[model samples]
Target chain A: MKKLINQPEDAVKEELEGVAAAHGDRLRVHTAPNYIVRADAPVHGKVALVSGGGSGHEPMHGGFVGLGMLDAACPGEVFTSPTPDQVLEAAKAVNGGAGVLLIVKNYSGDVMNFEMAAELAEDEGIEVEQVVIDDDVAVKDSLYTAGRRGVGATVLAEKICGAAAEQRWPLPDVAGLCRKVNANARSMGVALTSCTVPTAGKPTFELADDEIELGIGIHGEPGRERRKLAPAHAIVETLATAVVKDLPFGRGDEVLAFVNGMGGTPLMELYVVYNELHTLLEGWGIAIGRNLIGSYMTSLDMAGCSITLLRLDDELTAFWDAPVNTTGLRWGV
Target chain B: MRDTVTQGGLTAWLRAFAAAVARDREELTDLDAAIGDADHGSNMDRGMQAVVGKLGGLSPDEAGVGVGALLKTVGMTLVSTVGGAAGPLYGSLFLDMGKAAGEDAELTVAQWATAVEAGVRGVQARGKAELGDKTMIDALAPAAEALSAAAACGLSLADALRRTAEAAAQGMKATTPLVARKGRASYLGERSAGHQDPGATSSWLLMQAAAEALASDAPPDRPRT
Candidate 1:
């Protein structure tokens, strides 16, 4: 309820306007059906990468649009999936004659809309390939739920695939690499506080001061379990253990350790979580080859952090090391 | 004794659906809060409001517009306006139904059955959800099947639609014990059980609206317990 914004309804529009103005050198923002495309898009002969989801995850699908990440991103209203039309338009704008790749998160709305968009694009004779990221280890894979929710690894996938696309990888190859990243990665998150969505004007869930929600998605939905709040080391241990065990990551495997903060969590706490994560992995003998530690993906003003570990081989490690420049992530340029 | 549904009846069904969603919006959001994000009611209400507004623009004369076109318009509107998984799923249902109805100003009971079945199939295809998944399909699939069976039995359109509503209500209630296999609710794992699926609840309300519009002489705004 207490946030810096002019109006609840105008939150997405105003935020997008700010993004366009600030990052105008690297991206172009389109309205009517809002979408952000790389400023230098239609890169001749290279496959285009498009990814989007609900808007509150700043710098994700949008801020990541630039030289080495997503070519276009369609942001929906806060905590809402973007419509198919937005996806289709973005695909049309960004396709460089090498086809287009849609990096979709595995939420039902996201998957359905992106799939519909892919069909619509194909109808218009645009070759479109899509890969769904379901890297969150918190959601159990069972007959009761829609598998795992895509979380931190989505950012990682975009980065790796974007690098591959920059290298002029074919649509299929880029899509294939995306799937590989999804397959090799696992993520888990814990929330210390609930987030307040603008329109709702209240917290999505009420968390007692002494409790934490474990295995939470980015939308402020309650996690798998609620437990007494614990120290940073214990929290990181739980998250890291779950992700590491889910991937069954081995002692000799090389990994990209990504410790991501959910918007409200400060970098200080994230580093604390990262410190525990690093020590935990080191004890397990898993080598951390490349690392990204920050709030790359976040829920709106929620205090939490997620750990994503991508099992990397020579090829994936190379892509991870490739140069990149975007608002949310930048290095190796 | 109506043996078929006319375009006016289809429009009435949508209006009743809008009313029902508006009435039950908070209930749906409360249900969603337990296992999923708490926005199903608000999102569906917003979409249905747009649908009713668009429906109001149509001429009252049945000859002016076919049921397919009207339903397709509703689908498109919902797809554009509704922001969550429910939007695309519900939109697909109506769009596929419209495709199945195809240019018909009036549809026989059997034709309506075919359209409902097609709509349910479209939802399944778009959501990739199966019968046991605790989604809208839990209600919609059974209602579609029951409609088809009732139609095949040579029942009147009113009776078939009423039976479909009953099946949908039963399916909606059935979701209380199941584990969700799709959508955000699935994130809760075993904890998701015991809460009725909000999508299924909305699907039941829509089916009830159809029955009220086509099966009974009851007014659209009549309260249902």
Candidate 2:
């Protein structure tokens, strides 16, 4: 329950205000329906890219909204999916003459809300295409459950698709690229300590000091299993093995390796994870062509990390290297 | 015993549901915490409060739009305010119900049965959750079936609604031992069993609210605790 906030109920709104203030030069924060769009939106001929989910995953949909990243992000309440109206408003705000692409995570709420928004947008005569990201390997069976929850791979898809859209790729082409990224990537996470949602006023789950939850999603949902806490190498091995084998990534395959911190984890630890992942992938004959090591996608103040590997080819690599400017991610600007 | 549900009665049903949600917010959160992220209670309560607030602020012309329009507005309000899986599911329910009810100012028992069935079907269509998927559909589908059956037998409005509430309550109880196959709880797989579904629990409350508000001659301004 102890954290920096004026009130639990006002947490999302206040944080959005802070984001608007800090990144006003690059993005514009809209309220009443609450969506963030690039400052100079409706970039004329370019297709717009929109993605969003619950509020706690910072620098995600919202922070990615600028330049060669997301054109708009609809942030919901903490740990909750944004509504259709918010999504619709965002689409309307950023839709250039080309069209709009919705990059949705594969949670039930996000899927349904985005679906509803797509329908509404179409009704308004706006062309819309949707690509769902369901790259988490934790949920083993799509048949038995609501399918895999989108995790680290969502960040990668957003960046690559944003680059494609920025290059004036058609809406369908950008959406197709997003779908290809989602199809090729796999992710898994391990949580050391439980996160406390501000409104809940307590830890999401009680993880014993000696135990860790494996295969966790970003929303603090219980994962595959809890086991005795192990060494960093063991944890990385577990995550990396799950991710690699799920895709069955093998020899001669090139990949974009992403080691993301789960909010509370430090950069130093993430690098440690990256170090282990690099050696492991090398041993497996998987070439790490490009790598991103940071807290780009995160759960709120959760002490954990996730690894995502997207099989890469020339097209994806070029898009990944495209010039971009955003508050959370920047490189070849 | 009311034979028809007036626009005022439908409003009272929503208000009663809102009050019940506010009262049991913590319990819903506890249920969700067992298998999913613990926000169902707070999210539902917030959405219900917004629906009530919107009702309070309706202009005279807006209020005069009849029961179906009012329900559609309520559905839209819930969709916008309630973030999570519950938002779209519940919003679809009310929206479908409103569509079924048409522009009628009041509805007979058979019409109410049709509306409930339509609402439940909308939920199924939106979530793609079938029976036994361990979702709100568990409670909602059965309640819709029971109401339809009661209407077929020419039962009174009160009697049909009472049966609907009982069916929903029984469905809620049944979820305690089943493994969830939808929503976040499904991520827990077998571990998700033994916890009553928070969405089903809230849906039962929704049916019970209808029993108390729409089926009785209760005043619109006075929703029961």
Candidate 3:
């Protein structure tokens, strides 16, 4: 309720304008059917990578749009999935001669919209392949639920697949790499406070001061369960254990450890949580070959953090180390 | 006993639907908050508002315009404005309905039934959801079936629509005891039960609006509330 914004309705549009202004050198913001595409798009023979979701999770699909990352990102309203038309436009804009790869999260809206876009693109004679990430371990895949929600691993998949596409990998190969990354990665999150959506004008959910919600989705949806607030170490242990156990990440397995802040959490706390995660993984004899620690994925000012672990091999580790230039992530440029 | 639904009646149905969605906006959001993210009400309202605005631009006696064109406009508006699973699902529904209605200025009761059935099938195909999945299809499928059956039984247009709305309401209420098998609420597993599906509830409201707007004595230009 108490946030800096001109109006509730203009929040997404205004923020996009700022993103375009700030990162104009690297990306182009297309309006009408809002989407952000890399400035140097249609990289001549390279396959294009497109991913998108709701608006509140800044630096995700949008911020990641640039070199060695996403080619385009279509953002929807806050906490809402982008429509198929937006996705179709993005695909059309970014598709190179090789094809287009859609790195979609496994949410129902994202899946359906991307599916429709793919169909539309195919109708227009554009080749398209899609990979759905459902790496969150918190939500159990069952008949009652839609399946596991995609979480932090989405960022990892984007980076890895982007690198593959940059190397001129075919659409199917890049998509296959993305699927592998999603399969090997597992993530879990715990929220200390609920976020207030701009239009909703209130907290998404009320949590007692002494409580924390575990296994939360990035949209501020309630987690698997609420429990008494605990120290940072205990929280990290809970999240790490869930992810590791779900993947059955065993001793001596090389992995990429990602400790992501959920927007509102401070770097001080993120590092503290990462420190605990390192210790826990070391205790389990899992070798951390590579690591990323920051607010790569977020839930719009929610105070929480998520832990992700991707079992790594020579190929994935090589792709992870490739040059990348994007607003949200930049290294080896 | 009206036998056919005119373009004017279709326009009125959309207006009534918009008004109903605006009236129940908060309720839909509350229902969504219980299982899915809380945006269904606001998202649908925003889409319908855009649809009504577009409808206002059409000439009063646009004889060339037909039900198909009007419904296609509504579908495009909803797809662009509503930014969720419901957007694409509902958008596909109306788009397929428009296709089924073709260029006819008016549709007989059987033709209306066919269009409604096509819309429901479009949602099913788009969402890949089945009956009892606790989605909008929970209400839409039954209503479409009932409408088709009523039409086959030689019921009047108003009577068939009334039966369709009643079936939708029943299906909406039926969603309470069922667990979700698709969409965001499916993440909640067993917790998704006990709460009525927000999409189904909205579907029911839309059917109710159809029944009201397509009644035999309904005014073509009922003033917006």
Candidate 4:
């Protein structure tokens, strides 16, 4: 029930204020509608990228708003999708003459809001394309649910697609690249503890000390099933197997492996999980062409990790290696 | 009984809906906590509070614009303030309703039915959800249908609205046993079945408020179970 905040309602705004103060050189924070944009936006000839969702997943959509990533991010209340007005305002602000691309996670709220924004932006004569990320393999059936929740691959897609946009890819091309990234990626997570959204003032869900929720989503929603707490190797096997088999990733396949922390999970544990993941992939004869190990996409302060494996082609690999600078991710720049 | 709801009655309906949301916020959140992230109650409460705030500030001249303008204002307020699926869904309901109602300051019962139907259509178009999806549509679609049927039968405004509210209540209860095929609750699979959908429950409250507020002159009905 305890959080370091002036008030529960101000959590998103206050954090955004801090982001503005700390990353002023790289980004600008707009209030009233609450969106973050690149400090030097309207990169006139480049296809601008806008991505957003609920506020709890730190650094994502917002921290990623800088060079070689998202041009803007619309942040909503914690675990709540940003409204269409926020998205529309962001799209309008960041739309370079080329066009704008909205990278949306596959949650219904995120989808509907972004869809509405796209419609609004289109009505205003802006060319807009939206790509939805649904890489989580936890949800079994798209027919029965809203579909798999977007997870770790969102970080990868933003980075790669941003690089593509920087390369002056057209709106459709950038949107296509984003969809390619999502289509080739699969992710799964497991949570050791539940997170407390500030407004709710309680844990989202309870986890017994001896159990873990496997295939968890980023929002602290319960996953596929709860199981007895097992060792790192065993847990990694369940997660990695679900991901690899879902895509039917085969021997000799190359991938960009991402091991992400869910807020409260320390880097130490993520690395441990990554190590096991590496060993498991090696056993399966899949080549790890590149790796990102961090808490890039987190679910507030929940103790868990999600592993995203993105099958890589030469194009994707090149994009991954592109020079990038953002508050959350930086390379070669 | 009046055959139409004036602009004032429409405004009262909104206030009543907002009050109902505030009263049931915790219960809605509890329902969501069982199957989805537990924010439905608070999110709706925040949106409705914003709605009431906007309603309170409307100048007398502005308030005379009509039911359509008032509903659009409410919809925009909800879309901006409510951050979840309900924001767009409920906002669409009101927005499309407003669009259908046009600039009319008063609407006959048949006109109200048509507007409600349009609003439900908007919800479907926005969410891409269908009936039996264990969504707000479960309650709202049936209510819209009942309203249309009552209107076709030449029922009084109060009688039609009462039937609409009853249909919505029945649909809301029906959601308890259905497996969710939409929204966050869908993630739970079979586990989502036993709980009543927070969205449908809220929609039921909305219809209930409409019956009460828009038909204030009618005799009181039996207490709800």
Candidate 5:
């Protein structure tokens, strides 16, 4: 309840104001609350890319908004799904004569909402295709009564999907590429401490001083289990072991290594987690072709991180290294 | 007591439900911030807004449309408007409710209980979570059970929902003692214990609101028993 802000209701609005002032040249606020899009997007001939989810995972759907990534991003309330109207508006704004592509996380809400928006868009005479990211390997798919939790590979998925769109690949082909990435990748996260939402001004859940959760989702939700806190190296070993076991990066496998912070955890710890992951992967004889580390996707401010490994084939390797430019990540531009 | 719930009552219930959530959005969000993601209130608000929008130009009798159409609409709205597990759970609940309603134009109180039972079934199907899992199912399942029991006793809508509300409150309280088995709180393991589930708490509120708004005209009862 206690936090520095004009008002609790105005936090998201004020944040959007700041974002607008900061990135007005390239982005514009959609009629839908919290939606942002390229000021001159869809170029009327390019594939429209729209992605969004809860607001706490900032610099994610929003930060990734720009050329070579997403054409628009819908920033919902913290840990909330953007309304279908917002998504529909984003889809319309970025349609640019080409069909729109919705990049969605695998969370039940995100998938369902995007599906609704796509339907709404279709009703409006626009074509909409969707790509859902379900790359997290922490919760067993069979145990998932909801669905797979989309995690870090979202960065890679959007990046590669953007590339395909930039090449003017049709919606079906672009969607296919996204599915391929999702199918090939696996991620697992753990948390040391619960993140405090600005609105709640408290941790979403309590984590004991001595305990750490393993296989967490992006929302600072609990992982599969809580265990005594282990050394950074041990944490990485656990994550690597889980990811490899589920996806099985073979002895000669080449992969993209993503050591992602849940939010509050620092780059230093992520590096520590990464160093251990690198060593463990080497031990397994799997090669890491590219590496990305940061709080690219996060819970409110949860203290923890997730590790993702995506085994790559020749096609994936090519797209993985393709050019991408956005607020969160940029390369080969 | 006669069936006091009417077509107008249905619309009124939804309107009041939306208003209540809008009024307490932050409290709901605050609860979620404590034990889950901080978006339950906002998500519910957004979904309610969509629900209200969809209700526009529709009659109360039409509101009792098939559970599939109603639930599909409600589920899609929640999915689009709400984020986190609460969305899917509640969405599934409505999906189930709609499925139970199954193309009926109007349902008596007993029919409504049957509809709710069906909704509960769908939620269990979707969540695979049971009572005491520290999910919304905790409060919802019990409330549905109580309503069904009260209906079987031939009570009017008022008495049935009174029991339903009582069950929901008890279910809400019961959530405090159990370790969470689902959603964000489940990740906290033992630490997840202590705090009441925000989703389950709100589910109680939803049922309470439903009973308060839907009950037919009847004399007030005596002290709690």
Candidate 6:
């Protein structure tokens, strides 16, 4: 396959080295393999927050690493998970007696790995708690369903959980908050084009010039269905409708909305999506308490977008508004 | 046909599998970029490399941790390290495998099969795209099904793996004419009908490695030239 790189195997390592070199001041490199932890991890007696997965979803787990987000992020090869050693090391390094909290998405691999880390930490008397966020509303639970997908909400979870950890709340409390965010949030996405894997040197799937996949997850998992391209407002309606049904928004409940772009899609498209979503929410009589618009979490350069909404309460609102100094989502101290 | 899968054999199997992924990462990724995310090869390669790194001093005391623990670690790593859909899909596979393997010091052949079955189920559950969707399930489902059938046939562990790999290869190839139903290619609707699925292709690599490295004794059919 033809692409810009010295060698296929060296791609991840080489790229990580570049990332470390660029963000070294704010992040520390993990030696077991390619991983990054916030420079201020452990923060004396503070609870540590660690989250990660594959590399292609840049500014995601890695970009979210900072004071209010992840204490450490173990970068796996492009679209791969980081190994246990890297996670274990991060756990140990970030542990400062107060315990650590793991924020994981709803995907099976992420859930399993984070759970394993918690077990290892407990083996060493380091208290650890984990919360898996399954917030996507696109795919329904069928006879072979694995529940909801974790889409745009992961960024919100990280930011809110990081805020909680920053407050030095006990592990259980912070973990609870992460779970709440997960439960309260829902996301749905769609894609227009397929992204080519760096190593594979081809698109993961084929997309006709005229069609699009709706209810797509960040990972390129199959969405609800494929149809000919439609207007921006129509797509927005489709995504929001699923989310609204899943969450069944209360009559006057406050909501936090996020319109996230899937890599290839530009701000222009996302803004168009956001405008449609805003109008739809208004029609539904749902009040938006907060909003995030951009590629907080993405699927390479796939041309698509996902919309996420969090049902906010006083506690969650406070946490959401708290300071998150990560590279991706940074605001409100 | 041994009824059990020894820890040593399992370890050897995993090590070899990890190495195989490391070796063919780019090829896998290249396949993925054709229809899905472009990072499968690199992502699996990265995850396997991490596994090798952690296996350096794996001790018996870690048994209470469960296969889920190791798999989960790999899953989390992938979520952060690897980008795109592969990280989550592969992560889910290992996560389910680890959950099934939980804290067991060693694995029986039946138990290993059960774990893989669980993992496969997990992938189907999470991704929602089925066997005909031209995703990894094309290869994975056939491998699991073949292994199950082989178990019933009372074949050796090696033979069972070989059969599974053979089935997986066939399944991978079966994707050529099917319209894409999952991942990015699903967007193509009718246009995606002719191309082979990248995820399914790499899924074959996983089974091929397992069959060759872990089940050499199986008298399974070889790929046709």
Best by DockQ: 2
- Winner on TM-score between 2 and 3 is 2
Give native contacts recovered, as a fraction, per prediction. Answer: 0.74, 0.81, 0.78, 0.89, 0.29, 0.06
**Interface RMSD, in order shown:** 1.5, 0.8, 1.5, 0.7, 4.1, 6.8
What DockQ number belongs to candidate 1? 0.60
Model 3 lDDT, full chain set: 0.89
| Docking class of predicted structure 4 | medium
Model 4 Cα lDDT, one tens digit per residue, A1-333:
878999998989899899989989989999999999999998999999999999999878798988899999999989899999999999999998999999999999999999989999999999999999999898999999999888888999999999999999999999999999999999999999999989788888889999999998899877889999999999999999999999989999999999999999889999999999999999999999999998998899999999999999999999999988999998888
For model 4, the superposed segments whose C-alpha errors exceed 4 Å read: B59-62, B216-225
DockQ winner between candidates 2 and 5: 2
Per-model TM-score of chain B: 0.93, 0.96, 0.94, 0.94, 0.86, 0.82
Query: What is the per-residue lDDT of model 2 for residues B1-225, given as tens digits with 9 covering 90 to 100?
Result: 679987778878899999999999999988988888888998999999999988777776667766788889989999988878999999999999999998887888999899889989999999999888889999999999999999999999888999999999999999999999999888888988889999999999999999898866654432222
Residue A154 deviation, candidate 6, in Å? 0.8
The complex in candidate 5 yields a DockQ of 0.24
Interface RMSD of 6: 6.8
Local accuracy of candidate 1 as per-residue lDDT tens digits, A1-333 = 899999998999999999888989888999979999988988889899999999999878798998888989999999899998899999999999999999988888898888888988999999999999988877775556776788888999999999999999999999999999999999999999999999889999889999999988899765668999988999889998888898799899999999999999999998888889889999999999989998889898999999999999999988888889888878887
Q: What is the TM-score of chain A alone in each candidate?
A: 0.99, 0.99, 0.99, 0.99, 0.95, 0.95
Which of the two, 1 or 2, has more TM-score? 2
Name the runs in model 6 displaced over 4 angstroms. Answer: A1-8, B1-225
DockQ of each: 0.60, 0.80, 0.69, 0.78, 0.24, 0.11
Clash list (residue pairs), candidate 2: none
lDDT tens digits by residue: candidate 5, A216-243? 7776655678799988888888888988
Model 3, B26-60: lDDT tens digits are 99999999998888999999999998887766555
What value does the lDDT take at residue B36 in candidate 3? 88
> Candidates ranked by TM-score, best first?
2, 4, 3, 1, 5, 6
